[model samples]
Target: MDRPSSPAAPAAQNPVQLYGSFHLGEFELALPIDALQEVVTFPDAIARMPLAPAHLLGMFTLRGLLIPIVHLGSFLGLPNGTDHSEARIAVIASGDMRLGVLFDRTGEILRVSTGQIVPLRHGSESLGLIESAFHLGQRILQVLSADVLSRLPGLPHVLNPDLAQQASQRRMAQGSRHQAISFQVGGRPMALPMEAIHEIVRFPVLEHSVLADSRCRGWLQLRGRPVPVVDFASFLGLESCSTEAADGSDSEDLRRVMVLRRDDSYLGLLVDEVDSIVAYLGAQLLPMPAIRGQAGLFAGCISRCDTGAHDLILVSAPALLAEPYMAELAKGHHDLYLVADDELRDVETTRQRARETWVTFHLDRLMGLRIEQLCEVIDYDPTLVRPPGAPSHVRGVLNLRQTLITVIDLRSLYSMKEAEDLAASKILIVEHGGYKYGLVVDAVQNIVNIERAEKLRVPAMVANQLDTELRQDLREIVDLPDQTTIMLLDSVPLMQRLTGNGGGSTVVAALPERVVGQA
Candidate 1:
């Protein structure tokens, strides 16, 4: 939809301003880049507020901040036919007012000049919402001011003094609370403290072991070690609801195995579907109701109000491990597998040897960088200052903790398509030759430990197609047991190549004098 445009001539002298544009109903809108926070995928759950305005869709927690979401089309009286499932939330902040506006989809980051923007007349039909308009080929781009939206009548005071104080106090109270991984077993809700879990993995093919019995399902290989898998519902004296195949294997698609850890020993608890991670204060849990045959296993019962739907039985890991039956199983496993002290030593030695920690991230495919090479990972900052005469790979200079770090887009360097939406992108801070640079990646996955033996050299066929620099950077690949392959990034050679010291031509040039001097 085109707004009434007062066409203005583009001037070379005008400063370029960045705007994060998005689609709302039939109208295209843009906000000053600095006023916008990161865009986020639509949250699964939004806590509905009682007696709130109709336009207020509800609120959700984003990185500890309670942001109230509003339906932009509903507030502006536009016909928004966009599906809620595919919508994205654009978080914007002005002074103390922070809000998330639901939009149909995100548009490109527009670099418009000041001379091209035609200021809207005050008290127009948009009611100060439309601050300016600019031409984009055959269409017009209406710029919305976050300050005006924040001050609009009938909007919720999300960061009001009273609410902020309450939020602060709530955060303080939550800081002392414990988090638990919630799951379902035999149609009943259960949870184990986060500290008790080593990792949660999808159900894998089980190999028959001596430990298999009424409670023990079978043994599953985890990192070259056999971890005894226990049917959680059977262990808790509850009949399993999962159906079995003709081959006597579990047929449920949602089955997950939670690997419980105690020092060097591991046990897997098979459950149906892993749910959300929840935090609860001690006082929120009611005392465990006495149940025959399952005594001392539950720490407390979390009410349905705290968790959704059915009350959750919080399992005490120490008590579960200390049970007579469970103790016998552990002892039997140790006796059968590791009877000798030398065998135990060998197992520990094998686990510790050549274990390299790598931070996995997504690009065109799964990729990794040595954790030691990275200083830290942080969210992508949109307020980067684009330096003049810089290479396309050099995104901009970001002021991080008083240091001007040059942010580089790895996609540009690799000659891949640039990411359209950077809502979920992360910047990996790396230091090389005393200079810190931020590498923008699609998304940062969890850190994983890869053994040297697990690393496979890149096939010669694959290496020959790539230019020498990329080929050297991705010389090895790690194939995990889960069928996921990760290309290991040789940071030393990559840094050297980027900094123009390697044998091959560099993808990145030397940092601009201004950026180098500031750093």
Candidate 2:
């Protein structure tokens, strides 16, 4: 398997953070809210700073206050775009410095939770006055610190030389988490870049009755409105809690609701509680090993925090949103923030991003599998059953259109659990060695375009969880944050684990042997 070339970056500072990731032409930006103030309509607040530096685009007056507006685009070497339907004057403030950063348009507001952020790399060369960044979907957002942000990127220098050099070194570093929030899955924590979370919510009722289907359901009420709830855990191959954490810690409090944007919808993820939106400037978080012959989706892991128990999961939710079915639904639900890629060609860009990345999912609950290992995605056809006593993972057989397919309960095979937090599920059909089997998955997440030089960060115990034969195929790990390591999973070995010699022993053996008996 190939490795990702891009290594993890460091955590962002001040207000601008990762989950704050948002689109701007071909570029994306995610910073802290503290880095920004209110955004007013462009023309309405076009007040220039009186005799301010040229780096300063000018001042804009808003609500009677004279605020200086800077051209963030021009600073970033992009074409000046002032013609926007709803132009906005982004008022940004960091410490003693304050500037109204100008934007072509006010993109969506990202609510990065504790787990989505990673730190920036230390000793980076591309620093150029920008410190860290957050990745959202297919885009990356560069973050600017208070002093570092005095000027925008790609523009001529104006700040003091000494300060600039420090910022640059801080960037392009060999070490740093890059994003602010990250999480752990299967024991490995990936950075989630904070700008992505909208609001963090905690609800005691999140733990729902364990339903049989890949789907898990719970109710979400917001501002007096009742919205349809979907299971997010199952979507990401995570196990849902039957009840709250053992400590009972505020699981029932429903303290915070993390609202995130996925294409056309705002996702509200329920968290146990909110942790610090801390900066992660430790080591570069690395991607999981490449195993399934596809570009892997997981970016990298974030080590345990000061609390040491609940780490964050930094990830690209839109990648999971792209599966054909959910993509259609997101188109409507996330209507307000949708881009006009009405031309399906834009999707090609996403495919291009896939150069060699792959992602993991479960066919049934508990099974960890990758979509690349599968041939195509299909629906479960109960009417297609054929024989008895096959693998329990094998959900019998199904006839789709004109193809004879065998249904495999990958979820059951991989041991993936359902998240009662958010939405739907998907099924993938994989083929190899002349045998074609359809595997059920909760949802198709993002396709990772893993770079060759990626780093691996995970807990030591989890690294021990990697199948012995599987460890050799992993990318590589320099320094594990909090001493955590993530060993990427491959399909062939997983297949053996699901149905092979000497593998059907543990509880996981239930699906394969059961299929043999029930078929």
Candidate 3:
């Protein structure tokens, strides 16, 4: 595989998460990006199986592999979306079963945050395959667990022992088990690892702050000290649970603040209500794919109760307060009360700051790329050129001042449909190892400055669960105060996809004198 000329960046502090979104009529659904292998047109030949369920569409040949086809609409009792020409097959692999699900059309690849996912309500028990659901604007998208589908009663076989063993080992590793404090926000259950929590305090004297971080909801007085408080709902990028009623008046009063302490510094998180402290097994916590344009607030998903209870999203306290701006705000609050007395004089007060910038843009939705690998953003019409034998991702080529640049469709690279209605779009001129290319995107948003401390390394297990294409190229995610997540795209694997250096079809610009040879 071809590597970028730029020095490799340090490991990401957060996991880069994404999921594939598709449609069944007007209903939208999502599957873990790792669970899906590819999206392809319906096979030309499909053989029916004897004694198979109605949901079983049949079997087909794909790249020399036998894949069973499933009618997802029939299984879910929704309108079948496969009658149209735009219908496509979503290839899924779970343990031993490799199946294809029929969908009306494939949508954008979502950069999903773990916190954005919520468990299905009580009445949704009828939707067997849906593990959880998430809100996308006014619409809610059901999250389908392909593994569960593979194990359905009517399925022909069982999971491979080797694959099942590997999955079991991953969930039960040492330190995976931990006690957590569970609470509710916006009527949804959430938890935090008890280790990061200092104490739970109710009805602490509160005062509004005029000069704290924007994300800070207010300040709380505790132990003769001031702690900056942030609304837990807003901090997690959700609508305020305490919203105005139809009469345009606020409903509930602020309930309690969870005081979290990291060393001498302290921060308070205002929540809707506090529940209970429970010891949770790591095996019970599942990695959740996040929604695009949001930050990860929850570490993972937890379903404690089995009696029609919803899944609880586990909050990562350290990462929440790890933002440099939040840290600095806490320091300022701490220093205001720290006197030069013999008891307090020994404490260190020196502070330093580290920040990183990114070139932000919109693909199918909000996305970002590090400035290090980006050359420039330009406006160009790619319909001018079409090359012979180019891969699907390669739209064509562009000549900028006589330098040949390969223009690739970001949507296609991300396994999304082409944006035909988008008459105009921006091209991101990016470079890797002196090889330059133009990435076509929906639009160029802006430049953003972020604190380095806020970035967290995505857990190894989470990365392992993702498909190779995404797991390798997408390694980091940053959540903004507004509750949007920006993915940091790695250029190395991206260039390899275009150059065919990683055992795939390569798209090379035809130049008078080839400036860079194909890898």
Candidate 4:
């Protein structure tokens, strides 16, 4: 390994650092070391940004934002060596700007320059970072500038959304990010992003009341507030390291409580041990060493273990919480039970609207559309028109999206005289057919997911009772809470009719029906 020359003991002191020697292939360029930040091991990342400087080797991301990685050697007419990983990125900063310049491996930091310098005649020369030429013993070093490197040609381009997408995908696949938060679960090490953890609590002695039924640690008084603690081992479906439960002693077993904030929920994760923050470097990891029974619980492991270091397996938290035990634990718990499903979670939450809409009702003792559909429940607003010459079931016209839609009283059409309760007659504002419509219900109630299997054929026996015209559209018979099968109204044909026509406002009585198994 060839090293750069050590700094001369300066009876004369210049701390700004003059000669920052970086090897471009075999040749040396004198850069100002004081301007240089620490050299970091550059990971192999994808470059997708366009209109990049010729010096840049495509574009890459640093710290989640898009930043380009430039190939100094390629631009400087130096030999094209191996990839950037074999090289190190020498970070240089000037004033408010910073950039990482690539090198074929790292060379020594030498301080040497001519008070008055020279130039090379072999290649086409550039004026910027390769400032002026100077001489060391047996070598010529061209002085480089950190400032000029950043401001080279076409360096001020903004990020392209499409290129950002490609780079993000490439980052995940390559595991290029090195920084990670690590800990121990069941004596096995695991690591994740430090950004993921809110705070870590040490050795929380979960009361039997909390863990007995709820995976939640009985709310511990943290700053006078009850914070939910999750048993990490149990939640991950991994076996606990120790079988003994806490006995309410002031002194308890050591466990780490990791507070995690998801979109709509905040929960605690209980771990057997906690380790120091580590740099994962996107290395490959294993879940468990051996497939012992339910060994699939672990994600994967890192091949090389550095003493206290081990590759950490990242667990999918939502999948673990979805276990049958979650519902059981949530039973009787004060808080309403809801899955912290990231996939299902809406980025832009609408709680008031969501609550109002997701509600259920009954018409003739049968389930109406889901409760969540009713954006509002109020006395019939007479200001909205009542469509004329419709049917007995068509109660009136309601204004939705500046259009009049015939409001249907579902119970009357089904001929369930017992279903019509005057006090329970309320207007429901439903969103469908690319517009909003209103329904007059006999009774309104809590909304729930109608749990039903698919492709239900209303058997030949009950076929006569359903709509002879719209029979094909009834795809499934979902049994609701009241145990009566509610029909899932097919909205596609209705939407098409409403949108296809002028201002598309009305639900046509007769239209093409839904094929069975459509859902």
In order of appearance, the predictions have TM-scores of: 0.45, 0.31, 0.31, 0.29
Off by over 4 Å in 1: 1-179, 193-202, 220-226, 237-254, 261-266, 281-283, 306-308, 339-519
Model 3 Cα shift for residue 346 (angstroms) = 17
lDDT of candidate 3 over 79-106, digit per residue (tens): 6444545567787878767778888755
Q: Which model is ahead, 1 or 2, in terms of TM-score?
A: 1
For residues 445-470, write the lDDT of model 4, one tens digit per residue: 55344333432656776766766434
User: What would the per-residue lDDT of candidate 1 be over residues 1-519, giving only the tens digit for each residue?
Assistant: 011121122122235666766778767888876677556667889988888776677888764568888776654556645358768788888997788888876654455657557676541223467788776544567898798777765666745566577766876775556566678888788988765665666677787887688878877765444578889988776876364532466543667787765544567888876664455666667897777877888999876563234677899888887788776666566556643544644675566556677779997789999765776577888999888878888899987655678888888877788899998899998877767788899998866778999899999998888655568689999898899999998778877767766666666555566674345
**Comparing 1 and 3 by TM-score, which wins?**
1
Local accuracy by lDDT, each model: 0.72, 0.44, 0.63, 0.50
Model 2 agreement with the true structure over 78-123: per-residue lDDT tens digits: 6666575544455565653446565543333444424333344322
Q: Rank the candidates by lDDT, best first.
A: 1, 3, 4, 2
RMSD of each: 18.4, 25.6, 24.0, 26.8
Model 1 TM-score relative to the real fold = 0.45
- Candidates 3 and 4, the one with greater lDDT: 3
- Clash totals in order: 0, 167, 15, 22
TM-score of 2: 0.31
Off by over 4 Å in 4: 1-258, 261-359, 368-379, 382-384, 387-391, 399-405, 412-420, 431-434, 450-455, 467-473, 480-484, 493-519
lDDT of 4 at 146: 66
Pick out the ten consecutive residues of candidate 3 with the lowest summed lDDT.
1-10
Q: After superposition, how far is residue 209 of candidate 1 from its true place, in Å?
A: 1.3
